[model samples]
Target: MQVVLRKLGRGSRAVVGRLVRAPRKGSVIVIEFSDGMHEYVTTPVKRVLRLAGREVFYIETVNSRYRLEVRGREVALDGAVGG
Candidate 1:
């Protein structure tokens, strides 16, 4: 699935890519960046929050927070876990 990942902090930029691994509790979230380099959020995921009736996701990790937006209609975020 195609996704845009942005770290929630000062001077953060969004990274567009394909989702190589889905987010699960205590697991790493992986994305194959548009530049062809794989980006990994190595900290075990703490939480995932989904906005009601939206495809956007907020993820909290051990050391940082992130905003992940699912792009395109070809993919459905059925595996996402939300709080």
Candidate 2:
């Protein structure tokens, strides 16, 4: 999916974007930004198993942490700026 990091919040922040490729259960999708930053969010098949049949799936990421959800993806920047 293509998303723009508009505002960064302290806790769980909402990511606004268009579902370019409707994510599937257990599917690991890549989120790319305008500034060339990318990150992968892996959906637990069990968590999204029900939504697997749907065309789009929205997932959430851990907040207030600076750990790279995965490798190769750029680390998210502090404040409201794309990494």
Candidate 3:
């Protein structure tokens, strides 16, 4: 008998995009990034992940979970609604 194995793509469940954290404002920091086409936003955030050298970061909030993928300077983020 022969068995078949499937391969998984690099696609993730979280929203994938490019986003960078701002220089910090007051008591919070801002995330300014490109949506693969455009840039936007500034909000209070709680950092929960930071792994250098080809790794993904995951941050969880009261209502959402954010996954950040880093590649040198180029980065990717995944946002899951409703945590």
Candidate 4:
């Protein structure tokens, strides 16, 4: 499949990375981009292994912080950033 890249940072719409797999508490997801930049995001379930992958983009507002899930076209985020 063809992949697209974009700028990502602290904002409403940030296409950070693609989901490597299911994330649990303390788990990490290796988000890769077409530009060859990558980041290791922790998962709640367990540790994560970094890897290369595709990307995404959109505008989102979450209710909470500790809970973040992506089911199809929807990205679910719960809890607060620092509360």
Candidate 5:
């Protein structure tokens, strides 16, 4: 799924890419950039919060917080509705 990832802090910019790995507790989140390079959240994920009935997500990792918006298609991550 296509997604836009933004770190929640000052000076942060949105990073658009394809979702390679969905955020899960105890795992790293990964995104594949358009340039074919992959961006990985080196810190282990602490939690994943999804808005009810929406494709938006809030991910809290060891050292950073992120907002992820899934675009184009519905993604059913583990623990989400219909997953």
Candidate 6:
């Protein structure tokens, strides 16, 4: 498996990490970060798709007006503030 890291946001230096597991289709991708915060991302076979000939899936989470793009392709997860 291979892991990649990317940085996002400001004022706290948010860190991002990603892992590609074996079995390809039904592999669980675990994501973690600093500040004792972490999220578990499970990759189901249904989410897998051949994008430009490469397998890919997406996972995201939003909390307290902070948008988090956890895994897979590059996309922003928007969060709402003060509903």
> Which stretch of 10 consecutive residues in model 6 shows the poorest summed lDDT?
74-83
lDDT of 2 at 80: 18
Candidate 3 vs candidate 6, lDDT winner: 3
The digit string of per-residue lDDT tens for model 6 on 1-83 reads 22232222455443365443321333344554433366545433222222233332232223211223334544322211111
lDDT of 1 at 41: 51
Per-model lDDT: 0.80, 0.32, 0.35, 0.32, 0.78, 0.33
**lDDT tens per residue, model 4, 1-83:** 22122223444333344554444334443444446566534323332222223122221222212223343433322221211
TM-score of each: 0.82, 0.33, 0.36, 0.30, 0.83, 0.29
Candidate 2's displacement at residue 48, Å, is 4.3
Candidate 2 residues 1-83, lDDT tens each? Answer: 34432223466454443323433334443455444565544442222211233323223333222212222223222211111
Candidate 1 per-residue lDDT, tens place, 56-80, comes to 8899988889998989545566676
> Which residues of candidate 6, in runs, are more than 4 Å off?
1-15, 20-23, 34-37, 53-83
lDDT per residue as tens, model 3, 1-83: 01111112354343333444421212222333334455333234444554554355455433344544444443233231112
Q: Distance from true position, residue 59, model 5, in Å?
A: 0.4
What is the full ranking by TM-score, best candidate first?
5, 1, 3, 2, 4, 6
Position 31, candidate 6: lDDT: 53
Worst 10 residues of 5 by lDDT: 74-83
Better structure of 1 and 4 per TM-score: 1
Q: Which pairs clash in model 6? A: none
Q: How accurate locally is residue 36 in candidate 2, as Cα lDDT from 0 to 100?
A: 51
